[model samples]
Target: MPVDAPRPSAWRLLLIFSRIGLTSFGGGLSGWLLREFVQDRNWLSEEEFLNGLALSQALPGVNVKNMAIWIGFKLAGPAGAIAGFMGIIVPPAFIIVLMAVAFSKLTDYPLTSIALAGAAAAAIGLSASMAITAARRVPRRAFPLLCLAATFLAVGIFHWPLLWVVLGAGALSVAVEYRRLSSGEGI
Candidate 1:
C-alpha cells in the first residue's frame, strides 16, 4: 500500500485515542498506542505509524502524547490535533491529580508503600513487554543490530550521557539509511 493519509472521523479518533490513554497503565503506553492506532485499527499503516513514532520521539514532551498530536493533525488538521491532544491529556491528568491528592494522605500508611512497590514492579514488567514488542518490529539487519548493541553499551553498561548516546545512534542510523538507499534497498 502507498500509505496515504488517513481520513477517520474526528470523534472516532478522539474516542479511540482517548481510550488508549485512559487504559494504558504502567509506563509502556507507546507500544500499546502503536498497536491500537496502527495494527488493530488500521487507522494508519505501519510506515506512517513508524514515521510518526520517529517524529514523536525526536521532538516530544511524551512519546504517546506527541503521537496522538501528529496522528490527529494528519487526520483532521488543527482541530483534530487539538481534539486528540485534549482527549488524551485531560482524562489522565485529572485521574493522576486525584490520585496524587489521595496518595498524599495515604502515604503515612505502610500498606501504601507496599502498594507502590507493587505498582513499580508492574511498571517494569510493562516496560519490558514494550521493549520486546518493539524489538520484534525492528528490521533484521546488521546495521540496526549494531546500533542497538552500541546503544545498550552506551546507556546500559557505560551509563554515558543520554544526549551523547542519542546523537551517536542517530548519526549511525542516518549513515545506515544512506547506505541502504545507495544500494537500491528498501528503507
Candidate 2:
C-alpha cells in the first residue's frame, strides 16, 4: 500500500490487536501480524511490515509488543500505540495467568504435552511461512544471497549465538550494499 493508504481508527486497531493477542498461542505472532495487516487488510505493504518487523526484532523489548506499537503508531499515531500495547498485553496477560494456573494442574497428563507439541508445530509452520516470505524479497544477487545463506549456516547449522551472527551478517550486508550504492553499481 501507499504511504497515504487509509488508516484504521484507534478503536479498530485495538480490537485487531486484542483479537490476535487473545487467540494467538505458542510463538510466531509476527507471522500472524504480517497476515492480518499486510495480507488481509492491506493496512501495510509487505516491505513496510517487514521493516517494522526487523526493527521490532532488533529492539530491546518483547518482539510482539514492539511490533504492536510499531504497527499501531504507523496506522493510528500515539493513541494507536497505547491501544495496541494495551490490547496485546492485557487480555493475553489474563489468559496466560489463567492458563498457567490450569496447566499447573494438568502437567501430569500426557495429553498436555501432546497439545503443547501441536501448538509448537503450528507456531513453527507460521514462522516458516513468514521466513519464506521474507527470503523471497531478498535481492537475487550474490552478496545478498551469500549473507542469507551464511547467516543461516552460522546460526542454524553451527549454533552460533544469534546476536553475534546477526551483528556480523547485518554489518557485512550493510557495508556491501552501501559500497555498491555509493559506487553506482546498484543504481
lDDT of each: 0.79, 0.90
Please write out the lDDT profile of model 1 over residues 60-81, one tens digit for every residue.
Answer: 4887789889988877788778
Model 2, backbone clash pairs (residues 3+ apart or across chains), number: 0
Best by TM-score: 2
Pick by lDDT: which candidate is best?
2
lDDT of 2 by residue, 113-138 (tens): 99888889999998999889998886
Every model's Cα RMSD, please? Answer: 3.1, 2.3
Tell me which residue pairs clash in candidate 2. Answer: none
Reference-based TM-score of each model: 0.79, 0.86
The reply for model 2, stretches above 4 Å from the true place, is 2-5, 152-161, 182-187
Which whole-number lDDT from 0 to 100 does residue 155 have in model 1? 96
Model 2: which ten-residue window has the lowest total lDDT? 1-10
Clashes of each: 0, 0
